[model samples]
Target: MNRIPYANAVGAIMYTMTCTRPDVAYALGVTSRYQADPGEEHWKVVKTILKYLRRTKDQFLIYGDSDLKIEGYTDASFASDKDDSKSISGYVFTLNGGAVSSKSSKQATVADSVTEAEYIAASEAAKEAVWMKKFISELSVVPSIEESVPLLCDNTGAIAQAKEARSHQKSKHGLRRYHLIRALLNVETSEFKRLMERKMQQIHSLKHLVSKSLHETLDLGNINSIPNTDDYLWTHGAISDETLSLERTVCNDSTYMRLTVRGRRSQGCDYVFSRVSDEIGADVEHDDLLLPKCLSSSSAQFRPLGLHGKIHAAIARRANIGDPCLPERIFTYLNRPDVQKALHANTTHLPYLWHSCSGPLQYQQDNLDLNIIPLVLDILKEGIPILLFSGDQDSLIPLTQTRTIANILAKDAKLLTMDKYGPWYDGKQVGGWSQSFGEERDGKNVTSLTYATVRGAAHEVPFSSPSQALTLFLSFLKGSALPRPHA
Candidate 1:
């Protein structure tokens, strides 16, 4: 009946999750979500975990005297939480095949793709590994080992992102802290020198390919002017087939200058161009952006009939977008005293009424050009297995883009296609189209990359197609190919 003890019990179990038992971490995380308002279902789940832990209390780690090399393993459950939509990340470090340290935590930010979630998880594990290495160096002989601590991750795309230096647009939305692992991979330990050398060689080769492609595809031009400080007018002359020369001319004051350029012609008249100033003290001009004034001005200069009435109607209609009834219903529900009490929310009354998304949040678009192709190539070179999947219903990042990206990475990595493009299956029914790529080593085809689509699924595959997603996940974990149809 009481909710206070639920928080305390969850907190007590969380200590074990953080310190020793990684197996219980996911369950604890799930139960902790309902801590503020524990329902009967939540309490039952917590009780189940407590019963399981009681039965396993006799278990203890017995480290062997030999084989003390440090190794890390990481995995992530993407968008496991329906409420917050956050991925769950779990990692463990082992000494002599026994876990020395472990962690399970919800990802700090939402990941747009499975690769992003796995990459963030690996980065978190890398941070812990770095700390563990430093700690072991003081306590034991791990410092003398000449190999980089192997961090095993299931996703190849994430592994590639970590090894590559380029920022990809797909991964640019990832938080900056996740990219710190790339820097750590290069600098924290000298054991990764081989990887560094391979990365540099790949970079040099990539530069050559890019330069060659540009030269072959584009018209080249040479600069015609050099800078002269004494000259009042600065010019770059004309470059290539450009009609106008870029010139910067000084104004009456030395600190101020203006840049003039051509504008598109309309009805045999050249439109006025906006001028840019070079100095901080220059006064900037503002365009006529007021709605009524601009509408009147546009009507004066070649306008269509019914334009004003159509514009008014459009403006009035635009205000009522989205589910009209949903907002009012949500507002009514949140204002209820019982609901607020149950949620433990609205403790402090503010001047303004409660709103859904009124938090002061600003996003810095830092990684706009981050391309993860090179990173994928780096992971392929390391002979790690990677699986890339997309939901067919996801138009935001379509299956076409994912498949094309995989093909490009395969080409860059020089991986031979193991199977031609064809339909893969789940329980005798068509799951989606797929292809495999990798190399043959020691009489076995070592698959480095696999690409598949989940038919009828949306952005979050598991949410829409749980059974199919489960089948695909099991295949990935088993290190076996996706099921093929019978002949």
Candidate 2:
């Protein structure tokens, strides 16, 4: 084969490999190596790639219409080239759900072991990640924020090296440029208020203002837990110290009854009205949760004030315990057509039943690793803030557990305590206790991460302590500290 034709074919394939077909990158890399000497083997490999591309000609890269976010994966084949004894580094970056950038090439230097090869690959990927982050930040269509681009590697050693500041003798031979990742990320700040505004925005995106906020807010439990009453069993434990303290100064049945009735009624009305409105608008838009929303909304009305109220009272009277079967009854009642019509619900005629939760609610135990350390680091590297809050009265996932998690995250992220854990006020009363994390000095504060517990709240913070929850929510949205009492 003529050298010119081989080089031309390789160049064309290289263009496609660099742009869209990342799957062919390794093959292109191998084939391009012998461009100086045209051989039957090199030509055979080139022809194979062309054949593969022809067979899969209909395939094209699909970048979906989703939010702009970058994530990357990197790997390496150790000393794969027998001729040169060099490893192959491969990396591909995704924007939302589709690939936007990729590379596959032989290492510039030979690596002695698999670990080193993988580390080099991850370093290369991190460089690309940083570049992509900068590019995405510049785009008018995307948010102008430095969000950490996650560079994933299965090699533990590479992750360790990326996080470590000090150089080890073993990795001394590794190029200094590859250590840029470590320099790019550091979460330390002396005071809560010293965190950069960009960091605050990142935190804001994590919780309240981003597209994934709704999904994050609604994940109530995993497969290990069941629904409704069973999940709230912890609330019935010996009243918490927080609840006991409130009992002396705030116990009043009339006040309690009035609040419960009002809250439930307001929630019920919203639920039903929303369902009715959703039904009316079903022709224009569709959602999987519409039927479930209608059922839950209708069920709320019956909980403390409607048909099931009597049944609950009777059950409480007979068993000398709170009603647990209300959900079962409510589910049955909402399935009735008359009840659906009364609520102006499910006009779309959904194929599924109107249950509060959908099936496959079960999650594997193996999937329950809820560690957020890496995730926190990823967002913090992007200059985002993180806020964690708990309802004071929630026993199931109590304040202690939440507080501990926040403290560990802060320590791991190297965040300084902006404010020691202390009471925050809502209307001259202690609404909750909170702690702030950031960089602070000379009384100037730049807060990054904040954690709070809503006083007198249940597992469902808003439902149990609406006023306090609102206060916390608003403060978070404003990226401000929870209010302090006048000294």
Q: Model 2, 107-142: lDDT tens per residue?
A: 887887787787777777777766776666677565
Model 1, span 1-487: residue lDDT tens: 4834788889988897677655566577668889888988888777767765654443334344454577777777789779999997777777656577777678888877788888888888888888877778778665434456777776778878888866666455444678878887787441221222222111112113212332132211100111111121122111111111221221111111111111111211111111212321122111101111122233243222122222221121112222212323455578787888789877785556665435654322233223455566777788788899986644334565577667767877788898778888889888888899989899888778999998765545664566788889898889888888867
Superposing all C-alpha atoms, what RMSD in Å does each candidate have to the true structure?
31.2, 25.5
lDDT of 1 at 106: 81
Per-candidate TM-scores read: 0.36, 0.37
Worst 10-residue lDDT window for candidate 1 reads: 280-289
Clash pairs (backbone) in predicted model 1: 160-375, 167-370, 167-371, 168-370, 168-371, 169-370
In candidate 2, what residue range of length 10 has the lowest lDDT sum?
284-293
